[model samples]
Target: MTSAKALLLLLILVNQQLLTADAELISLTTGAIGAGAVGAFSAIFGTYSYIKCKFNECCDDNWIPGNVAHKLQQEVDEKLYGQHIAQETVIRAVRAHVSKLKPSKALVMSFHGWTGSGKNFVAKMIAKSVFKKEMLSKYVHLFVATLHFPHPEEVEKYKEQLRSWIHGNLTLCDRSLFIFDEMDKMPYQLSIFLFLSNGGMNAIVEKTLENYHSGQSREAITYKEMEQLIKNSAFNEGEGGLKTSRLISRHLIDYFVPFLPLERRHVIMCFKDYLRSRGFPTNADEIEELASQLHFFPKSSPIYSVSGCKQVEQKVDFLYSDYVHEHYKKHFIDDL
Candidate 1:
């Protein structure tokens, strides 16, 4: 080959190599630039998914589950209103539901009324009798939100925060319960009224953690609120931190609800005691006398309970036909 021809071939080869390098660089650049968007996408999607799943059905919107509602209904049937029998029934049913490998939403069953009517004491008794691990394990993964003294502002703040966290962090679950005690105090609570009535609403647990953990804000929820949150949201659905929580929260609840199945999760809530506690009784009743009449003991003076349909039918019949609206609005309506 002549020198000129050889030089021409070398030039052609160098040009080919340059072209290859340019193509490779372009590919790398494209990939690099796309990485952040891809990550951001995954992060946002993950966060959204996490939020929806983690809190989709949280606390049955922070109220009693169907099973609990069912039991409460039964109590009402038996005229067990103004009694913790309804709550006890809920505990038993919750336990039954959990034992079946079924998990439930976290909820706050606000026990309210005139101060001193033994509502709180009744709640405690109801918890003891119905919320035993053995009972709740069967159906529910319990979460309790007992307010020490939830003022209206505090209630709204927590509710807004909770809704934000759920939207940003939580996911839907088949079943959970959030028992909000003293909701009457926080007249502006979300998901609570709907809960007792068995309706759907939203809450967000992820934003709650993010605002809290990143020092963007304090873990603003106080000890009482936190305890209730932990208890209610005992079955958290994420690895940790804001990002992961956001990613997994929504899907977590969604994932759980399907496998768990709510067909069997009928619930009810009951109101038996007409007051808060003996010391805080409604009306001008003598403390000791009112407490005595209220049956502060586990076993009632009448021995056998107002058993079965007779008791239930009577109470419900009256509430539904007689004065159900007034009953809830006036008698059972929590003072918060």
Candidate 2:
């Protein structure tokens, strides 16, 4: 009986050990499953939020917030000088288009013309009006085509990548703004990827011409004329034809705004802007003097600023440097 009791006790101990091991394994499995479930839920929630914002026009980082649309119009008019009619048209068009919460198509604006004619400046204004951080927003993708794809051989690769990038960003947020700087430099075939109009996806594309001939007599074609021109160019296989010509032949360009060469008045206005930006008071006489001193190229037939407003600030700094030197020479003559 004592032996039987000892055997029973040993069996009970063995069963208890086995139960403890099973309990430990069950606890570990439950813990792992719970952790996985939490992670998955977090991912799902994040994705849902992103999709919700895209559809509702309330992207966390992209869409223009309340009152910004109106403010943007004012800022564009005030800051972008000498482009009065253009600015008004842009403001009107953008405001009207964005008022529709769900636009079926993306707003595409093509800015072409002389250098320093506010093509890029207007683009930045549009971005600022739409986003809180404006150009700095994650949703704003600025691509210089020439800088991005330098080799002709990389055209195919660039096309695929560009398409994927646009599609992926649009999927994440339809309100994405893409600035294609130097659109003229973009390989014709590669540029076709940008005009893809897939349903349920929308984005703003601003294309700027960076390599255009200064002072070329362009007829300032309207959007309709541009479309017609594309059709003719593609069908006729005309000079300056693009591989993507066929694709853009029927594409609807929302706006094809042309920037004209800056006149002396415009240059003066630009200098004032530059001075103001650098915390200098806008003195009319000083601005006029600087504008007059700016040399134009092709001395006989001048149409645009030699360097646009690009060198205006540099000129201002030089003048200030001269002033400082003169003052020092006059004050410290004895010491010298």
Model 2 lDDT per residue over 35-147, tens place: 56455545655675576667654555446565555977778867776554446557776776677766667776555444566777777877777777678876788887658
Write model 1 residue lDDT over 122-239, tens digit each, in one string. 3333333333332242223222234443343475687676666444433433332233342222221111111111011011133233443467533243333333333233233232
Clashing pairs in 2: none
- Against the true structure, candidate 2 reaches a TM-score of 0.63
Clashes of 1: 114
Off-target runs (Cα >4 Å) in candidate 1 are 1-112, 116-157, 165-174, 184-336
**Clash count per candidate:** 114, 0
Judged by whole-model lDDT over C-alpha atoms, candidate 1 comes out at 0.32
